[model samples]
Target: MATKDDVSQSARGLLKKVKQRYMKSADFNGLHISTIWNSREDLEAAAELVTARLVEVVGPSDYMNIHIRPWPTRRKVADQIRELRELSDDDYGVCLYPRAKALKRTKLPKKCEDAPFAKAMARGRSTLELAFFSADVLESYRNDARFRFGMGDFGINFWLSDEAFDGHQPEKDHVGLMHLGFAYDMRQYDPEVPNTPIVRRVAAFYGDLDDLTPEHQQRWASFQVGDDGIDPHPVWYASQMGHWPDGLGPFARLKPGAQSYQRLV
Candidate 1:
């Protein structure tokens, strides 16, 4: 039985193959492939190779573009804190202003204070960053008559929510929707690479992704899945920094089950 992660991996692999076939057939029409992941290191490593291949195949000219949109750390912290406050009466507070002020005053490492979103928000400016593409893709698929007609046999259902910070804070429950992107792009590429069987196969796989609909794909893509479960904040933070909490120094356990419930035999 393939897990959702397994399915996602398979889907990505098929998409890569389809893209390759399409490039070969269409004289490389400046196809751009961008991927978002939970780890900057992993994303960078993957992008290096993919970018090289794209350059090799398309010869620049926007023929290949690969970007790794790691989760923004400072923005995530702000979002998490805001969410925590919204959920419960707990003083789930992070000293955003103090942290920024300290960094500025001391001229220490600017990493914490230098975050664009953090800096902007720290100044008491109203800000909203929308991950619209992810939403737009799903909407396009859902509303487009041509796409819907073509995908008649296929059905895609998608839902988006902030689940990464869930259960972590006593407040509002989950972080706001900061990280957003679409997982369904089969239709977008299908017509462009109709001649390529690989493209067709990839489209078919996604077309038949019944167990996991487009909504499920979107949710899973947004949240980070781990041994503990879905944790968006950790995933987003780790993605931005390219390291997990374990990589950081000693911190309280983010997950449970470490303590022995009973003495093992």
Candidate 2:
């Protein structure tokens, strides 16, 4: 059995063929998304905790966009936190200042005139997310040298919207969406791309052709799985910055029998 759990012999054969076909069709040159935390529960807990914190500072909103990126030093991050704190008082601050281009095609609600950047953008659209950071959370990273040198763990994101997903691509309408990809000739390519186990299950199960709705059948027809391939940029940066925590590194311990699979084992 190629997978850990026993799959039927027929299913195994079908899965193998499917993977081969998918590889042929998938754009290996594309970028892939990965998570920083170990499990869904942890990720959710962190998000909820951040949401609570943000609510205390900025009034309720409908959405969030967490941004986790490298930082030069804690002082720099502290400086940014100070700026954000000042934004709360300055109604006409940069944080609330509207973008002329964003308002050109679509006029946002009058309420948006005084709302945060996140809420303003979501005035009319179905999805609106905002960038946020918590001083308390920053404290967690302050003492850790890894974060000080830029192996920072997390950031905060918030959003507000009155609409639910209607199955259209939000990326097409949204200006903030980012696409991370590598050229076909890049050296980071891996036959076994890194992904969470949950993603693996969804891909393995939905990937099969045993049953399909007519609409899905058409959608999968000639569908190019624009995948996000392995991104080692963080690891490379961590190593270059001289604080790649190995035994307890963010990307390490993903192998079998490690902490990530302890529950399954």
Candidate 3:
């Protein structure tokens, strides 16, 4: 039988190895540690080991959360993804995408007329518009049952395309070409009880800025609100000017009582 010290040492060694492997892989940037164990005791042990190692290696400032699940089904996975997306305070963060093809089909509305973006900007309406796949759809993978995987809390999913790492510079513009957003369900853990406090605490742990302070307000003036409860001068001006490549001079000339400038014609 293995002694307690032996088990502890073994767990620590495994965690160290895992962390080293992650650091060696260039593709694992911003990746978080997530694990699934065979038993509750094993899960807790692993969590403690992983958390301690991560804090020592990555620092205590890094935001980390351990998710424990008895048996995670497709619906359970989808629910978890949804919850994380809804609670995230970061400007950019992780979300779940069922699969590559499913991720590709996800898109924002093309036309501004009926789109949520247009409605939010023009009518001051804020609503969720993204389509989340049903659990039935998520479990459609051929090998999904063979392997058990866990995503970091509030982690994003990508289709793992060849173009993903192509020309991927840390400083330069590295746009995500293929991704899908998802949320998770924590209903089983807390049925009817709100997780607002937990979510806020996590946001604070991550140093995520949800609401702006007075100092931040002034600093972000160009990108923030204006006196008329609208966007700043440039943005408001652009909206009234339409989405044309040229300046607003052409559109302004069309207004009534405006000078018939030759250049506008």
lDDT of 1: 0.27
Backbone clash count for every predicted candidate, in the order shown: 8, 12, 14
- Per-residue lDDT of candidate 3, residues 1-265 (tens digit): 2222344665544444443332233221222323222233433344344233221112111222211110112233333333333332332332111121211222322222332223221121111112222223223221333223222222222222344335353322122211222333332345467653211000000011112232322222222211221111232223322433243344555766546443463
Candidate 2 stretches with Cα past 4 Å from truth are 1-107, 110-113, 119-134, 137-265
Sum up the clashes in candidate 1: 8
Q: For candidate 3, which ten residues in a row score worst on lDDT? A: 199-208
* RMSD, one per candidate, in order: 26.3, 25.7, 23.3
Write candidate 1's Cα lDDT for 1-265 as tens digits: 2221333353344334433332232121222322221233323322332322221111112112212111122333333333323332232211111112212223222321323332222222112221212333344434533221122111223322234334253332221222232123233344566553211111111111212333434443343212221112333334433453333222212324433322221
Per-residue lDDT tens digits for candidate 2, residues 45-115, read 22232222210111112012111111111223234334334333223221111122222344433323333
User: Candidate 3: deviation at residue 151, Å?
Assistant: 35
User: After TM-score superposition, what is the CA distance of residue 256 in candidate 1 from its true location, in Å?
Assistant: 6.0
Of 1 and 2, the candidate ahead on TM-score is 2
State how far residue 223 of model 1 sits from its true place (Å). 13
Per lDDT, what order, best first? 3, 1, 2
- Among these predictions, the greatest TM-score belongs to 3
